[model samples]
Target: MMKRITKLVMVIFLLTGISTVNGQDKYGTEPKKCQQNLSLFHESVKAKNFEGAYENWKWCFDNCPKASLYVYSDGIKIAENRYKTGDKTAAAKLINDIYTQRIKHFPKNLGKVYSDWAKSLIKIGATKDQVFEKLDTAFKADPTGMSIKNLANFFQEVTDRNKDTNVQKVFDTYDDVVEGVNNKIDKLTKQSDVINAKDSLGKTLTSKEVKKRKNIGINLTALGQVEGVLDRIISKVATCDRLIPLYQKNFEAHKTDSKWLRRAVSRLFSKECTEDALYPKMVEAWVTSDPSPKAYIFYAGILEKRGEKKKALEFRKKAIDLETDPYKKADYLYRIARTMYGSSAVSYARKALKHRPNMGKAYLLIARMYAKSANSCGTDEISKRMVYVAAVNKARRAKAVDPSITSKANGHIRSYSAQFPSKKILFVAGVKSGSRHKVGCWIGETVTVP
Candidate 1:
């Protein structure tokens, strides 16, 4: 530094035209152009311009060495985009390079980009070990993320991808594809995580979390190893005893996030260990507190899943009444039809079709309702078989409107093709007549696990 100062002084004294890059920091602070390039990179991604993203990202990475961490996320996103959109080799190269060069920056964004990128990898069918490895790396890099445990827990189920019979039946409908490199991570496949998943919420652990734990117990019911999952959920809820009042007070806070709460409800329903005395109240809490269409629908769906047809129908109707989304309202109506499956269900399904004329699921429901008549599950003759043809026609129309549900819609059509119903039709309404009697009847007459 002294030598440079002396040189500068001598240059000025000698009146020489010695020059230097003014305003440039010797420590390599990024230039404004780098920021501009990064912005452009984001814009290109938003615009789906893959070519532009690579170019802009390249410029940003070259100019902003210190901010290379930021580029890693973008690079990963572009790589996924490339893979999903059909540039397999290029996508693989991009993922490999970004992962290699930015290993230290793995947890830089933590949740926003990092989690999403991991989800994308899962969508591509990443193996469980691979996803866990990445998440483990992320935790090692920045274990401070509020969702660290939550993400870990979420990925625990990746292996159960096959368990979603519904997703498997309608897999082709949703455009879920992540090509190129394999995603070995599978969620829902791992053992339950014991790590504390501190909620990312700014508020204290919410009544919502309590409710969430409450529901987790429910969702664990009937699944294999039900006792263990139920115990875990009960433990979580018990930990929040002091937070019960807060959970009660902040019930309204959940209007903004009812889906999460409903998920907890579903989880709770899955658990078989819930106190019998607490069951009705817990179900009521979900139904009344989560008044949103989705919450109501999910709650009703949970009841329907447990073969509580009357309650399911009621909740389904409530969802239909609360929902403002035309599509969603139709969806609820179809759910109602799925539960009731008579003229009443048919009426709602038609109403749903009327509201969202293009919805294929509604048409599928119409067919299912038609097939309900032929359902041998009923002690009396099933609803009626002739109506199924009309239902199939409606389902076909729905498929015409939205091609995605074509497979399921087609399934509905084929379901009628076979006159026999493969599944049971629990006299759901009969169960509501009285609890003890219904329990006895269900125990005596209902189907059991095969």
Candidate 2:
């Protein structure tokens, strides 16, 4: 009986020991399966199931970093693809092998993978130091890519930020507290604060420093960012104010393409485009980069806004000359003849008909000009009547050609007819009875103050 009890106790110990061993190995058995999964990972990649490939690769790297080729090679390739497609998760998973457990295994290519992560951080607006920290981590793991030049460039930015920068002040302050370690013991921490970090600002600062640092500020201001800053404050600011010149200054520096400039201009004009100081040079740059007839048209409008009508008309004519189609050119001529002075109206109207024979407005312009010219003759009754009759006939023809002009042409006909009723000088000479200008033809009685 004692032998039987001893055997039972021994049997109980054996079962308990087996149970304890399994409990100790609870998380340890994962890697063997991870390696088996990694063996199938390349097939997943070949099958174009990138998610499966990444998942398996991630598991293998974390669980079994010794799976030599998969951790460094396949993981990096997928991470790059992740970066491009904006698949942050996929990208993180792909690089997680190099970043996490397997970094110590392959030290050389590991640093590059961290550099790649820093690049990703930059796209998302990480600060310079944050980027450098990751960059340093990569260098620590694999120092191959940690170039002397990169260190120098980054360190230069920090030093420059602390210097007496005469760049445009943002008028806003950003508080930054930086801690520096004084010695190699890595024990002592140095602390400092900086104020009013003058990043690219909208202030069109007129500094003696302006000429030198303008390019640096402009460089920081992207083609898009420059456009945005100019948009917000262009209206509330003055034209001949200090800022006017910087628009021209920066325009000269840009290697702008037509599409970007077009969008930028459209954005600027959507706000206070009529501001005298801004539009002229803005339009100038548009023409400078790409001189289309449309560019000249916009420039002409800007000139007109600045009360430079003569310059405006010159650009308008340039637009007309640049026009390829004769019909459009005729329209341009009509605009010039009607709105501007001299005896060109009759001739331009005739030319317009010659180019576009069915043009109705041409007949109206010619008739009006002739009627105007005729009535101006003081004593020539026959010529005046003849011109009046000619004017009436042409006005009638315009009415016949296009009914849309009849209402307008009739008003012109009535006004000219009443203005020169007799076309004869009134007998009284010293002073005209009514001073010549009349305010007749009221539909309602006028109000008089008592």
Candidate 3:
């Protein structure tokens, strides 16, 4: 009888401990009630019954905020539905609470959360400063996680606040935002290329792949839009007059800073302020401090500006050699080509194409070079005009390879095609429309007589 009583007491204690553990679970003091409400909330959401989901969602949110991420995600949907159905005040309050709770419970994607919160603030007619505060937090947390639209908004806020008093901040913000957007665009472009290739080959994509392709397109478009916005915002303050003075004042302080020197050199180069005395100083400092591929490229541009073509070519070659990324290598080659003319330019452009086969800009650059060389390449009307045909061919190839530049390539094609040899001239030259003709001089390309 004594052994039985002791064993029964031990069993009762264990049962009480189990109940305490269950009560203290993540689902709060009422674990069973929280779980039941969460299930009902999720089911109603799946059924698109926002009105029915609200009570259960509120219960889960109040009782078990840390239960699951879906608590916040589904809560957001419920709030949005409320907003759309004319419950703006209550919905906005709930959204604000949900964002706060989400950050408290799940802070991994804080950048996206902050950005979404900023957008919500905007929708609720919040002040620019308030919106900017959230956006600033988002960008600083994880710029890559922020939407392209939010990035644009963030930059605009920075510009509006600093454009006059702290222009350096504006430039810095512009660089950061543009770099982030470009990185995203580059990534999305690669994904888009793969999916497009598969689709072009008549391969059927899975539902997920199709959705991914659509999202890539949407993101690419948003990135492009943001780029335009950034350019427009910076153009006003990035002119040579403003940039020269700004860099001049800050050069002594930032001379040893490679990043500052690089930005100064890049901005000066872009604004055509290289003619100023400070440009070479920044370039020299950049190369000395960083000595990277981009630094070498900037130094090469300075050398070329000073008419030191041989030394410039060496530095450009050095830049190309230092770069390991195929895309960047191709870009360096293209940049070097842009500094040249005639056959040399075409040669470097072709080298770029070797590294990146779909580099349509290189082909377009070759087309422009060919068109400019038309008169120099041939003496006769027929031969001279045939150069335009070569240009047209390259432009068409550019359009075929890179959809991003189709409009620009089409414009080039239209202009070049107009300059083609007249039918009378072709007939007089005895060159049949379908017959192949070799272009003379540096081009050395075969073309159809048409």
Candidate 4:
């Protein structure tokens, strides 16, 4: 009888423990009730029944504001439905409330939340300055969280508002957004390369991989469009004439600011404003401030201009020697390639690839060099066109290894393929299309005859 009583007690204890565990929740919501409400609202959302989900979702939201991130997410859907029904004021308020609660509960998502808030404000026809304030906050908090459209809009707004007084701000924001865009493209390209590698040697990709590739391609195209828009908007104020004076005026204030100096020098150099005295001054300031490889590269350019060939070469070599990061080293090498001629450019490009195999731009550069030297690379017409074949091969390899430059590689492929030796030429040379032919001269790359 006593043993039976002990077993009963143990069963009661187990049941009590289970009840206690089941009752507690992350946000201290009554588990049974919250679960019922959350499930009902989630199902309604899935069913597109915002009306059906509204009451339960609101109840869960008010009762357990910290229940889950989905509470706020679902709230947006509910609010949107409210707006569609002709209650814009209430909808806007509710949307704001949802964002506020989301930030309160999930502070780590602050950056993205602010960007979403800014976008929402923009959609509702907020004033340019108001929208700019939110966007600036978002960018300052985390530029990476912003979408390409938002970033472009942000820069446009800044330009519109402060075009006369603060051109530097416009320039700085442009640089930031461009870097962010390129970084995003690089990431997407690397992802594509991985997915592409999974396909068989002679077979098609799986359905899942195909879908993934399509999504990446769509995103890259969208980003490219946004970049075009950004350039157009910034071009109004970033003209060489405007840039030179504006930079000259502020040079003194920002001379010690290495980041600012580097950007200023790079911009001036890209605009071919190097003939201006300000360009050399900025470059010298940059070197004095940082003395990094980037600064040294600029200084080297000045030396070359002054006809100090030996000094320029030494400075260039010093920059390469000082750069420790493989990626940075590769970038320096690629820059050197740009300034070089003939086979020297190809050699430096090849060296850059050694340090960073994913530098697709380097491959494109090498291909261009080969195409330019087609007449010099071979003694005969067929042999000269074979250099185009070599260029096309390099371009194809670039696309295979880095999807970020796939469009560029495809362009090179098209241009070179059109210039390829006709079948008649191949026949006359007694070379088959698939047979390898050596491209003599400085470019020793073997290419398939076409």
Candidate 5:
């Protein structure tokens, strides 16, 4: 008798379109209808019939909010189409809704979703605070997932908000963004290197590989732009005058903190603040606390500044040996080269090339070294001008290897080419324009007379 009564009540509830809370599934009550709508919407969206998809999509969205992630993803496409067709207000609202619901149902890729949301907000002329709110969340969740442009914009927002009262926060944000960008660039560079090597061996790439190479190039270009923006934004506040006092004030508190010491040392070194009284003290503390490769490099710089060349080179070698990453090792070699002169500097730059063949800065450094030595390199005007030929050759190589430095390398090429031997001078010296000539002295590079 009890079983019969329960069955009757359940039948009545079903007939009356009522379901207990515990009995509800992700597809909601009347799941067959909800699933039908989901299928109908999906098919319509696939056919690019957004108008046909809309009603059914809305039904699924309202009735079965957690049915599937595709509901929101496909909805975004519909909304974007609408946005492009002049349904500005409604489309933006729907897109925001999709982002919110997608995040609620599927929390994966939270950072990317928030960044996309922020970008959408920007397009609709949203206030800075509104845009920043989304960006801040995105940056905190997963900075690596954010686009290069978004990362740079986030840093700018951070700087504007904290520059006056909390300048350290601004600096920290800059470091974080730069580190993220460098990490991404490093990964892409390794992949690009592999593709480049295969191409050099005359192996044909697949369609997918070719597309990937193109994308990597585009991304590298964007990342390079972001880096330039970051430097420009930080340069104003990162001067030695500003950095000296800032570090001086924080040194007492951060002396024993290795991470803090490293950043301080790096910033000071980059700003060329090594002559200050506080620099040595900070370096000593940093080395004592953590004698890492970078610490040793800074220590070497100080030693060289104090006129202890032999000791400096010893520490630089120590730094090089301690570093395990070939890229970092190359960077340290370049830094050491920057402090040297003439042939020695060129030698160290070449060593850097052995580790990272795509390093354009090393080539640029060599070109500058050769140009500076032109006067001392030759006794005659024609011979002196031949050094510029070698310099131009190096600048051209720099431009070819690294797209990021194209403009800078072109400038160098132009400057060097201007100093090429005049037509009459070449004739008087019996040097044909296309004839090979060896530049003597420190730079012994052979180049065609131009």
Candidate 6:
């Protein structure tokens, strides 16, 4: 179905002549002349003959700016080669012209075009501010369409600006950009899930679909890297002391603005500032103004803090029940799990998995919990290290199922596997490497020792 839809969209583009190179009549160039230049440019580009491509590509750019996108595509290649060969000035101007023409021809795709433009500028050694301006324009125009690099870089630049006296801009950009990255990650993960679902049903993907899945994996991996970078950038600015005073100063003025209040309160909660007096007040105000599932979660936190365990559980359940999207419900449950102590975190994480089976991070979370409880799970060293085997099993499962976190999960598996009791120690205990061993305590999963 997805392939059919993709082909249909391609057909539409072809029908509209958007995919043709010879249809540059609107640029006032003769069709035969345009075709000749386009053909020559493509042939040269295909042969890696940037110098040979340059003259023909230049004719298309000068006389037929509205030609097919490949004109710009080949032009960028030529420009990059020229720039690397020391003609930086000429190359920069031509690359900039390519972007301008592409935008003029396809104004609707400004976000992505501008992001590409910003990336080109970075390649040419453009100043940070120049790159930032282009990325900022791209983000504001269409954040979800922007690349992971742009999204993360924009936040970093905004943080730089915040230090120069626009602190609120940093907060605003972080909120918006992080949300955009999450949306993109969710979108790509769903694409992979579709392919994985088919595979699970014994329907192997065609070669084309396999390629598509690989691309999705590549994109998810890139997004995961940017997410870590963004977190590191924000961590420097989001300290509890810095956050509390900043929120305290604006709390009264923005109390009625639920969006603002929620952002403030959520930031505070994430930074573990819930003990502050302002946290409960903001939670109450958020519930009064919006009553969203997120707001209910904050209110639940307030209840938990007051030692009202039963009431907190009820509000938390209400929050989870109010959420209709399985992914989001799982996210709320995951958060609840993060906030909980002892064995209950694993239970909440399991509940999250019940709602969304492909949430590999949930498995990772469970593994971490089991590892944390290893010392108390058994009295003997051998029995305790058996918990590492269970932890490693979950991490391995996560890597097998989730492409987005495959790298991280594999790292966990390696680290935990190393911590497992040596084969010599296992042999002394009458255990074989391939034999099954039950990990007692809250983690009842059986794992094969290595």
The best candidate by TM-score is 6
Residues 1-450 of candidate 3: C-alpha lDDT, one tens digit per residue: 999999999999999999888666678888888889999999999999998999999988998898889899899888888887967888888888999999998988788899988988887777888888999999888776788778877887788888889999989887787677667767776787788779889999999999998777666555556656677768888899899888888888899998888777877877788888888988998899899998888889888888998999899989999899988898899988988899989999999998876678899999999999999998899989999999999999986665556667888999999999989988887878988888999889899988
**10 residues in a row with least lDDT, candidate 6:** 19-28
Candidate 1 lDDT over 1-450, as tens digits, reads 999999999879666432222223311355567767777888787787866688878766555644545577667777777788876766766675666566443435554344454555565676766665665554334322314333334323331342233322111111111100001011111111111134323436667656654443332221222223323433333223322333345445663454434543444444442334333444556667666776676666557657887887776667777788765676677766665645667677778777765555666665565555544423442223323434556667765544445556666767664542223432433322112211121112221211
> In model 5, where do residues sit more than 4 Å from their true spots?
1-77, 80-89, 104-112, 379-382, 417-433
Clashing pairs in 5: none
Encode model 6's per-residue lDDT on 1-450: one tens digit a residue: 999999999999888886344455554347668778989999999999999888888988888767678888788889989999967998898889888887787677677878888999999999998999899899888876678778778877788877558677788887886677678888887788888889889997899989998898777766666656777888878888788888889888998899999888888877888888988998999999998888888898788889998998898899899999988999889888988755899999989988777788988998898888889886788889989888888887776666668778988888888889997898898888888888887777787777
Off by over 4 Å in 1: 1-130, 133-261, 267-278, 287-322, 374-391, 403-407, 418-450
lDDT of 4 by residue, 1-450 (tens): 999999999999999988776557453557678878988998899898998899999988888777777798788888778877857887888887888788888786555678888877766666777777878888887766677678777777888878898888888887887777777776786677677556635557879889998888777766555556777897778778998989988888998999999888887877677888888888899999999997888898898899998998898889999999777788888998988888899899999988877688899999999999999988999889899988998898887666556767888999999999998888877878888889989899787776
> 1 or 6, which is superior by TM-score?
6
Task: Compose the digit string of candidate 5's lDDT tens values, residues 239-299.
Answer: 8888888989999999999888888888888778888999989998999999888888888
Model 3 stretches astray by more than 4 angstroms: 1-49, 64-70, 84-87, 186-214, 358-360, 370-450
**lDDT by candidate, in order shown:** 0.50, 0.52, 0.86, 0.82, 0.85, 0.83
Clashing pairs in 2: none
Q: Which portions of model 6 miss their true places by more than 4 Å?
A: 1-29, 144-152, 406-411
Q: What's the alpha carbon RMSD for model 4?
A: 5.6
Between 2 and 4, whose TM-score is larger? 4
**Clash pairs of candidate 4?**
none
Candidate 4 yields a Cα-based lDDT of: 0.82
* lDDT for 199 (candidate 5): 89
- Candidates' TM-scores? 0.38, 0.29, 0.76, 0.81, 0.80, 0.88
Q: Tally clashing residue pairs in candidate 3.
A: 0
- The TM-score obtained by model 6 is 0.88
Model 1, residue 262: C-alpha shift (Å): 2.6
Instruction: List the candidate numbers ranked by TM-score, top first.
Output: 6, 4, 5, 3, 1, 2
